[model samples]
Target: MFVSLGNLQTLYLHNNDISSIETGTFSHTPRLQRLELYGNNLTSIPQGVFDGLNQLQYLSLYSNHMKTIPPNTFINLQQLLYLYLHDNEISSIPTAAFANLPRLQQLCLSSNQITHIQSGEFSNLPQLRELQLQSNQLTSIPTVQYQFPELIHLNLHNNNITDIPANAFSNQPKLSTLHLYSNRISTVSLTAFTGLANLNTLYLYNNQLTDLPDYLFFGLSSLSNLRLQDNDILQIFPNTFTGISSLTYLLLNGNSLKTFPSEELSKISSIAVLYLQNNQMATLSFTAYDMMLSDVSTVDISNNPWQCDCQMVSFRLKMTGSNSFENQITCTDPRHNRRLLKNINPEDLTCEEPMIVRFEKGDDNSVEEGETLHMVCEASGIPTPDITVILPSGLHETVESGGRVIVEVNGTVTITDVTAADAGLYICIAASPVGSAFKTLSVDVQSKEPATVTSAVINITGKPESTLGSAPIFSLPVLLGSVIGAVAGTVLIGCLILMIWCKRKAKNPPPVPDTSVVFNNTNTTATVTTSGHDQTGQGWSHNVTNPGYAQRPAAPQPTLDLYEDVEPPPNRPTSKGAGPKQPAKKKALKPPKRNKAPHDERPSPPPPRTGAAAGAAAVYANEPAAALDNLPYYQPLTKN
Candidate 1:
């Protein structure tokens, strides 16, 4: 019961209870360019369903019960360009199901239950320009290498895709608009858009992406609108949006971003509308707003988890009543969590007090007498404070005077050429609109020399020498003169003893000689002369020749007892070579007398004895003894 119309170019079979697309159902229509088979109960598209339709250009198969598309289902439709298979129960497509359809351009497979796509499934469709596969059960897209140079738009929303392969859209050079929203995508590879040269619009909202790679939008030069809201994006690279110079609108609300990517996002000059609500942003840094100053016109930054601490006080003041953030901006946390900033006036927002200011000085306090007192004042505050100084001499001035003052915003001061007049209490005053504080400074000037006493000379000459030992002669003049005086007194006592002996000799009388003699004279006459000078020269030359000298008689030799009969024992041992007989008795040895005081006193105190003195004494004691023994001895005077 099949109609055989081999010349048919179009077919319409919509709203029918068709259970399946039978094999060879389009066998007679070899040149059919359009087919309509929507609203049917078809469960599957059988193998070889369009085996002979080689020039089919349009097909509609929507609202069907087809669960799968068999291989070679559209093998003969090589020229087909538009295919609509939306609202179907299809879960999968067989490999090579449309292998020969090289001219397929617009394909809409939306509202299906498809879960997977095999590689090379669309390898033959090199002319595909528009692809819509939204509302499916796909977890990922195949990494196909086909170059669809005419592809301008791709819609893959409402899917379960969790990941995107690197460079998945590289070969699509003409892809300008991409719709990938309402998916379960948590991550995107940077290379996912490697070759998308003409891509301009991107839709990535309602996903689960927590972080974006640095170069995720690198090659998309024509990108203008980027939608990435309703995700868990906690952090973004500082240069994430650098490549998209044409980007104008950016949506980033409903994310967990505590900070904004000011470095990367600010480079885009065309950005006008920015959406940044429902996140955890506490406060906006000045650097963040400074980056987006080119053409930003509107921004939505509400519903954030902001903390209204003291650090935010300055920011609150800056944002309130300011033209920079008057109508388009609002705070999204703290007391004004959901309140419109336009409704709340700037004067109504109050700022909290800042932390206390802490000041620090240098470590060393020893300032030079005439040098500058270099004092540094380091303090920390929310809004920097103004510092003033009061000098010790009651001179008040700012820290800029070169005489003894200099100040800085970093809390440092230097005082120059500080003198004794500059020593005393100094006060440093740090003030702000909220409150003021003061600190005391003390300075001391020290003197430079050691203390001692001066005294006159005190003579202790006649006093006994100290038992412990005399002090050094060079110690002081008074002590040295005392030692010299004691030594001179002992010399005077010895000179007096010699004078007393001479006086006693002058008072004594002379003794008389004996004149009785017996006969038996031997012609040896004993001559006696009263005068010391005898002109006859008979009494042993009694004339005294030397000046002031007395003449003395020669000593007598001992007489020998030759006549007495004595033993000649010693004469038997005499040798022929002996020159002369020795004297029988040696003269009695005299004991050395103690040195007198005047002669023994040295001209100067002997040099303190050291190792050099001991060496000199040893040399003198080692000399020959004969030289010392031959020295003449002094003889004593005797009375006759």
Candidate 2:
């Protein structure tokens, strides 16, 4: 019962049990604008089914059992603008099935069993704008030239796409929005969107992309909103969005990124909202926020796996102190953790073990004299471990040299001023409350001088003296010579004494005019007398008297004049009357003076002397003059 209807602009044949649509089914309906055949049990679309319906603008064939479409099914329908085939059992489409549908604008093929699309299947649909192919088994989109030139929206959600081919949408210059969520896309090619200049929104959530390709959106100059949540993206390329100048919103939550590409993405001045929550990032670079500028207001980078290594300790402090970073970052791993990074204290993120701990000798093999061998122990530990050096002599010393030892946390010790006695097993012990370790060092000492003895000594003696006793008997002459030598020595001593006495008398001579004077000898006393001299050298006699002798008259220029007129004392004897029993009278005398003046110019006479005085003066005169030789003399002046 195939009936032809004229001037039909709409037809409805929904909810039928039709299994097949024969060719030339609508060949007479040239002005048909709309047709509805949904809810049918169709199995296939035969060729030339809508050949004469050139003015058809809308069509719906949803909830069918069609498995394949024959070629040239819609060959003459050039004015068809809408097509709906949702919830079908179709698995394949002929390449030229829509070649004549140039005016098709909205196509809905969602919830189908389509597994593949041959190239050039949609190349002739130049006016097609919106396409929906969600919930299909498509592993990839075909890359055909001029396939959908006016395409503005595409929906490819819930597909089996593991890889996106390069330039997949190169022919779609007018594309603005694309949806590829819930797919198995593990990688995106750099030219995935190479020709999509008018693209604005891209949705790629719930995929398996481990890394963003370089320049992934380079040709998407009009891209604004991007959704890439719930992926296995561990990292992002440094230039992921280099040419996406119009991007303003980006969603990167629920990924495995250890760090964000904030620096690279922020080059787009129009970016405002960035969602980076649920990652494995530990720290954020300072340049990350600086590039965002004023256009960015919110950033959600919470739920990430962060580590508390020393290199990131400072960064952790900064993120905890600031409101923009710490408050937004959340810990996702090690399940028993806080919601926000700011809530977890920094002290809780302490390091567990030291990085390096060891000892090194300056010269590992040999040492020399006067050269100090250094033993250096270095360690790096958390909270600074204590370092100490134990010498072989049971002594401990602190490290001070700059290069020999260094303590990152107090686990460094150095020993200096090495000596031979210090050559033994040296130990460097590094200890902390947590644990301790030790390193052993063997020191070899070398010296030029032996270190055994301190000093040495030597002694010597002369031989015995020789003798020749009874050879010569001429000893008399030798004895006589010895006596003569002794006499000559005595005479020489007497002469030396006399010379000394004369020198002393010359230095202090006796007075020439005094009457009474005293002199001393080595064994006796002596006295001197002199009378006043006359100018005429006449009648000016000088006399010297002794107690036992008369006064002696002065002779003319005589050296000595003595007269013995009285008897000598019984106890004393004169030189002429001396007996063996009487000692000779000892006397000291001065040489007689020579007169050169007359008697008229003589000095006045001296006072007379008593007998007792004369006796005392005589005793003084008889004494030797050797003892008085050193005394000074005085002379009286004569009156004119």
Candidate 3:
């Protein structure tokens, strides 16, 4: 075992047949700083083999058969900075194994059999700047609350890590590059990267992420490139990319995304390249196209299941105008299926004899004033026609099947919770690539009436032939029951609507009138309490405490006066319920009573209290929108 090399500062014995290092073999090399024993047949390193190498800073033992690292094997190597133990059979890093190595900045334990690393294993390496634990059997990163302030790069790719907890990268502000791709990560907390303020490159591709959490990238404000391709993400929340405002390249290819992340992408103006290939999206929504960025130099929208139909007519025009990705996009549906979108003509995109298909309910197309109308226009075409409905009120609603009204990709129109406001002629424009068909459906919303006139007064505008046809015979008792049910449903629905309206009004109360305050004395400043919590220390009361005002003589002093107590408006309940009606609390400090002598008076009311005016706006803290945000995140209203 050659233990006589005492003054060795560097030793290169790599690619050797050494199967084992004897105890005390390195006892003589007290000043060893660089030790290269890589590509060796060493199965085990003795406990005290490196006990005397206190100056060891570089140790390369990678590509070896070493099954385990003995406790304190490198105990005295306080100067060790670079430890390369990758491509080895080492399974786990023992607690305090690399203890006391203050200068150890780079640790490469990649390509090992390590399944778990005890918490305190890297705690002693305070100066660790780069850590590589990739290509291992680790199912998760060790739970550690340590702040790695100096760490810059961390590679945990090709592992089995399933989840990242909140503040997973805590306090590593200098960390700029993180590679966690090719892992099995499915869930990440909102604060997973809480302290990664300087992170610039993040690779989470080839994982199992189904949906991105809200504000997922909130801390990486310095991030420039983000790779999240090859995941199962179906939709992105509006502010998922809250951070990374300066991102230039975002890769989202090879996912299940059906809707484009227009809102999130629009926040980042520096985005130069955008990848959205291989998704379930047929076409971009109107909002997405409206916010299309100009700085995007390259866009990859190819490989998606694009439906080239009438709804796409407008989008096709935009797609054609977008010469950058025009040739890349293609249709995945009938007729034009597999055809390049750029090659399709605008005249070729129209509907084929599109006409209304009267269904069971609303068969005659005439619906009750309160009942919903669900209708579909059947059109014979290769690619199904897209339906766009225009209401009588000049409101052009592009139907994509949602909301109080929904337009499905299959030319179905649904008007949920309809009312008299919806009674009018609705023009349904069914369009495909071949041609378009316009059909006018008149909706005569009938009003509620007595049992005797229910059949006679009910207007029917769907078909003249159907209305002229024989009316269905009904018994007197059936007619009575129908009328009773109609009245009951109307009353019940009206009550529910009223209750909902009252609840909303109570949750977000309107602002009260301005409470003006005039400070006649310049010797003191008043700290106005804007929060209306109570009467004394809190409330709508303007507290004017003038310690100097009390010094004035009592006679002819004009005390600061307040108006009458604010009463709750009609049918409005106060926040704390009605309190005992008493004199409204006003500031005790008062201005000198008109200075009795006219010569001493300024002859005008003081300027309006600017402070009171500004503070009034934020007095109500429990606004409905703020209260609702704590309840649940908003889901997609509707998508094409």
Candidate 4:
């Protein structure tokens, strides 16, 4: 079908509509070194079609309608170094279809419909360096089990690979660049790139990665450029880039990072260009800005929800003096939406509103009267807010160092010797140019109970200088002791008075009983007589003073008439001098006095009527010394 052309080194047949090629048509070109058959309508290659082209070094069958390749199709083309079969309808390749091509260096099967490749199909290609299988229906990485020692580049992007298993590229030690972007890759094993010591560039963007595993790039020390943008990456592991020290370019934009990746970037200090735009970051800290701007030469952090508050003061200051940023770092806040970040002044970077951090004590507090009270109000704002404390007495204190109520500069309020008047709501106002924040505290001051003798002593003796304008504090025990002592003393005095009265009454006995006379007959007359101070016919007499010396008035001598059951003559009256003479009275006998019992043997006086009085008596009796000790000694006040 063709004449012999042994010296032809190249042939151009691309961009033609050739649908079929006759058998033995390329048999005449024995020494052909290059053949361009791309942009053709070829469907299937016949068996042993290239058996005569042993000297062919380059072949182009790309952009064709080829579906499958015959067995040993390029077996005779042992010297072939470049084979372009990409952009074809090839679904599957037969076993050993490309096995004998020992000198092949570049193989392109990209944009094909190949699903899976059988093992050992391309194992014999010892000189192969680059393989392109992108835009295929491949579910997993091919040629992973086989070693491509000399292969330098591999493109598996835009595939159906959901996960990169451990050591997926371990066989490709000499690989410098890998293309795994635009895949369904959600997770990459930590050791996936273990043997990729020579890897320089990696593209894994536009994937479903949520996070990068720690130490995932441990052995990739030579990696310089890593693109992981346009991913669902929420966070980067702390040690994910541990050994990637040579990294210079990093693209982490278009992610779900809520915070700046400072720790991860700290590991890659050599980064020169960084892209962190289109993230979920609301505000950046000063530390984050310093870390980002210190070493990176070019950084793109735009399109983030930047909060232009006090937190962005440092960032604004740094941007104000620099001219390196070209893109507009727009703010998303309502106050400065769509405004460039560099245009905002540092002094104008006030917070949306003043924030009250907290109160040292709770909002509702309690304190005892005459006690020191302290409360702290912590607040934060952009313009260094001025703190003022409003007292319950409607007094406003901005800065106080020494007084009954003091509000310190650090938002601390101290009130010495708190009284009932100090109990109420205290308001802490933190005002700034932007806004103000208020914190209210309610304090209940419990009034002290009435004091006793001991309480008075303690109050007089307590430190007076510390609580100058406030009430003096009293102790509970002192108050209680004073009350008890006063009660006991009253009861003791009453008992003593009663005892003295009783003793005086017992010492003097009533005058001797009065003598009475009775007459049974009408003719008899009788006169009464008594001893001791004029008893007057009465039985009992009380001479509280000197009863023994007093004598009763001598009554007339008693006369007795003994008339039994007989009426005497009515007119028979005895004359005053002629009356019957009274018999001489017998001498009165004096009673002997009984000796008093010893004090120890005497019974205790009936325990002073039981109850509060009895208890007080018992206490005073049992602990007389203690009661005496607690008694207050009065001293006359001097005009000192």
Q: Report the poorest 10 consecutive residues by lDDT, candidate 2.
A: 610-619
Cα lDDT tens digits for candidate 1, 1-640 = 2367877888889998877666777777787888999999887777667767778889999898877777777777778889988898888777787687778889888999988877766777878889888999888876674467888989889999998889788778889898999999987887888888788899999998998868778867888889999998988887787688888889999988877667667667788888887876765666655554435777776566554434354444555454445344455435565665545554555443333254444565556566666665554332344577777777766644454467764556676666677677777777654556677767665442223324444445655552343333343455557788888877787778778877866665332121211111133222222111122221111211222222243322243111111122233222212223333232343332223245444333222211111110111123343442332222222223
What's every prediction's RMSD, in angstroms?
Answer: 27.1, 35.4, 36.6, 26.6
Positional deviation of residue 258's Cα in model 2 after best superposition, in angstroms:
1.5
Against the hidden true structure, what lDDT does model 3 obtain? 0.70
lDDT of each: 0.64, 0.66, 0.70, 0.73
> How high a TM-score does candidate 1 get?
0.50
Best of the two (1, 3) by TM-score: 3
Model 3 stretches with alpha carbons more than 4 Å out? 1-8, 28-30, 285-293, 319-322, 352-640
Residue 500 accuracy (lDDT) in model 2: 99
How many residue pairs clash (N, CA or C atoms closer than 3 angstroms) in each of the candidate models, in the order given? 5, 13, 15, 4
lDDT of 4 by residue, 363-395 (tens): 448878888888998887654566888889998
* TM-scores for candidates 1 onward, in order: 0.50, 0.50, 0.55, 0.54
With candidate 4 superimposed using the best TM-score fit, by how many Å does residue 612's alpha carbon deviate from the native?
99
Ranking by lDDT: 4, 3, 2, 1
User: Which tens-of-lDDT digit does each residue in 261-322 have in candidate 2?
Assistant: 76667667888888888776765655664553345777776666654334344455655354
